[model samples]
Target: MELQLQIKMNPKLYLRDPEQSPLGRNIIQHSILMIQKIGFEDFTFKKLAVEVGTTEASIYRYFENKHKLLTYVIAWFWTWLEYQLLYHTNNVKSPKEKIQVVIRLLAFQLPDQFTFSHIDRNRLYEIAITEGSKSYLTKHVTQDNKDHFFKPYKDLCARIAEIFREYNPSYKYPRSLSSTLLEMAHYQFFFKKNLPGLTDFANAKDDAGVVQFLQHLVFSALKKGS
Candidate 1:
């Protein structure tokens, strides 16, 4: 049997849902590669259309602009990540252990990950680390927020907060800590790799040290005031 994952994304996120058609899917799949290769600032609809072997108009039929497309891609990763958290933690009986699972997911994509056909989870992770905030850090962010454009990310944070509550029901800042934990995971990697002086793990080759640090940070917080 074959199974596929579906995320019920907000309808306002696109003019046409990319998952419904091949061309739309191609726009998504190739956009990730192009954005990764050239970066989001240099990435444009015209360039993406050329890479996808389609017209710029065709790309716009699915997304209003590069920013919306970036949001869609980031949303997909967050939704998928929320699902991954649920899937991975389903069998674990301990909240501490479940949190350990999440720290790992935030730091790096695990080997032998289940593949999503139209989305490259690994590249999307890189994009999320590098370009994720650009999606929301715009002039029209208030309107975008009203439309629930960032529900996926908020949902992921909410899920982690629940686990934190599970670990220590009396904790006052589960939601804040959850969101902060996610940001630390993304920024620390970016800092260590690109701006080495900003982080202690600058000399480290992989996120093993980052993951260890997160596990310590989270557990220490949950243990505090308890």
Candidate 2:
């Protein structure tokens, strides 16, 4: 699979840009693995340094702390997801078909492709599905937003909302619906696996069933305005 994807994130998220050096890039690559292997709360720079064969001070040079690092990784995922949405929907002609494609993209399992040789996107997606909320739901989130840390996520929502507008011109809650679609995709999948009673997907492995439920929820709401 040939996937050429490039995402530019905010400079303030990192102390030194990871893209600038191999060691810096390695910090990001290994951090993703560590965070996935050990949940974000338990992950530490000391452990990551050992895993990457570097000192904790070196890791701090790239990120002020682990939370900032988490934000950077999650931001990268959102930006890449927006790229995927834009790529798949570009040639789609009909508004309904375009919206359907967006739903599928939001709900589908991530592909295993070496789009970026350094980052393992499959693991990153798993992190997003599980630990994404922690990246933003913190006391410093307001400060992070002041630095424009959440821009990529907001951009992704705005793009999807635009598609909602195209599908129904007068839809007042396009942005709300767009964000809900994205969150539901993550939350429902999380629920299906860990807290089965919270979601309707009976089988935890039923990805297709989850997508079908999302389609029903999205289109049913959209069609109400038609």
Candidate 3:
């Protein structure tokens, strides 16, 4: 794997830094694979410890619980995504073109060459699409927010929201639209795959059609008339 970049995720999500040592890295790498294979609901530290050749006590040294680990992985993802967005869009001049770029990046399939550390970019996307909501949609969300466990995601949203304002200063729902577009990218794909009746691209095997649909939805709303 290529050493392209390192994302410094929010520290509050973990007990010991997973990037600090080989054991920590192994924990993160294998946890991602396990969560993707077993689903988060069925995943447990005991199982993860067995997979990583470590004891449950050792795993607990890094993360408070499985939920914290989940949030850490997802937070790392958000930071990685924000980096990609800035790297790709740094030179683009127009806000309209920039926002368009953002939509495509968010909704597109994982490129085979993209990666960070030893983690599989493809599996990470799968986890994000299916399990990302669990990171925040919980009774603990209030306390998590207070701890800033969600800062990376919020930061990513804020960056896109700024572009929305740049595109149309008078638009009243820049933040709402920004967050909606982000969620829509994931939800639409999930709906298309699992609940055909919920989306127009029911039979679509890829995100190409959904990307076009998002472009229409966003630009149409940004248009002065509607």
Q: Which candidate achieves the best lDDT against the true structure?
A: 1
Could you give candidate 2's per-residue lDDT for residues 1-226 as a string of tens digits? Answer: 7677667879899989998899998999998998988899999999999989999999998999999899999999998888888778879889888887887777654442327888988789879988888988999888888889989989999999898888888878889999898899999888988899998885655588888898888788788556
| Candidate 1 residue lDDT tens string, 1-226 | 2346777888898999998999999999999998887899999999988888999999999998888889999998898888878778879999888998999889765442455687877788889999998998999999999999999999999999999999999999999999999989999999987899998899887778889999988999999566
Model 2 TM-score is 0.94
Task: List model 3 lDDT by residue over 147-180, tens digit each.
Answer: 9999989999999989888888878887888889
Off by over 4 Å in 2: 109-114, 224-226
lDDT of 1 at 118: 76
Could you tell me the TM-score of candidate 3?
0.93
TM-score of 1: 0.95
Which residue pairs in candidate 3 have backbone atoms (N, alpha carbon, C) closer than 3 angstroms, thus clashing? none
Name the regions of candidate 1 deviating beyond 4 angstroms. 1-3, 109-113, 224-226
For model 3, state the Cα shift of residue 57 in Å: 1.0
Q: Once model 2 is optimally superposed onto the true structure by TM-score, how far is the C-alpha of residue 45 displaced, in angstroms?
A: 0.5
Ranking by TM-score: 1, 2, 3
lDDT of each: 0.88, 0.86, 0.86
**Candidate 1 global CA lDDT score:** 0.88
TM, every model: 0.95, 0.94, 0.93
